[model samples]
Target: MAISFNQAFAGHDKMLEFRSERASVLANNIANADTPNYKARDISFDSMFNNEQSKLRLASDNDRHIQGNSTMGESSGLLYRNPSQPSLDGNTVDMQREQAEYAQNSMQFDTSFMFLDRKISGLKKALTGN
Candidate 1:
């Protein structure tokens, strides 16, 4: 019997990719906290999930391909955060907020990594009969 890893993984792989991408975006916001007019950006997991379900899946040649929903003026799940407190230089990134978000994202990433690791370990044990 052929073992389909995709079926076994159950979309956790994609979730991991999304989480990693979000981490990069959050880190960018933190890095540019002092830049004038730099709007803080974020990725919404809920919006991403909704977009995935709402569209027909397609095989794309590149990971950089803009998601299909972007053509319709949808934000493509990348959103500019509204700053709660305005800065003197017109920069929107709040260091404390960004740090908190990055920390939360990091924790979630670790949790997902653990889940994926456990799944792979279970599969390995099943295959080895150990």
Candidate 2:
């Protein structure tokens, strides 16, 4: 019997991709901190989840299997962050806030990596019967 790995991985794969893309966006914001009129951009996971919820599901091929809902290649929302205080040069990137966000994003990326690692390990254990 053929087992689709997609059935086992679930949404975590997508979540990890989203997190990675978000890291780049956050990094871009930090890199352009000094550029005038450069607006900081961020991704919203909640919005991405909500958008995924409306996707159409396909029928299962057999009675023993469930339909897979894994959709790949999602581009982030990339919305501009509104600055709490406007800078004299119109740059929207806040150094302190950007730093905090970068740190948080890094933590989240590590978390997602750990979760994926644990999941793969569990799958390995199951297949190996160890």
Q: Which residue window of length 10 is worst by lDDT in model 1?
A: 66-75
lDDT for model 2 comes to 0.81
Give all candidates' CA lDDT scores.
0.86, 0.81
lDDT of 2 by residue, 1-130 (tens): 7756787776678878988888888889989999998988888897566556636576787978876675652544567898999999999999899899889988988888888888899999988999
lDDT per residue, candidate 1, 37-126, as tens digits? 899999998878766665665568999986554343255788889999989899999999999999998998898888889889999999
Error of 1 at 107 (Å): 0.8
| Number of the top lDDT candidate | 1
Q: How much is 116 displaced in model 1, in angstroms?
A: 0.3
Please report how far candidate 2 places residue 75 from its true position, in Å.
8.2
What lDDT score goes with residue 95 in model 1?
95
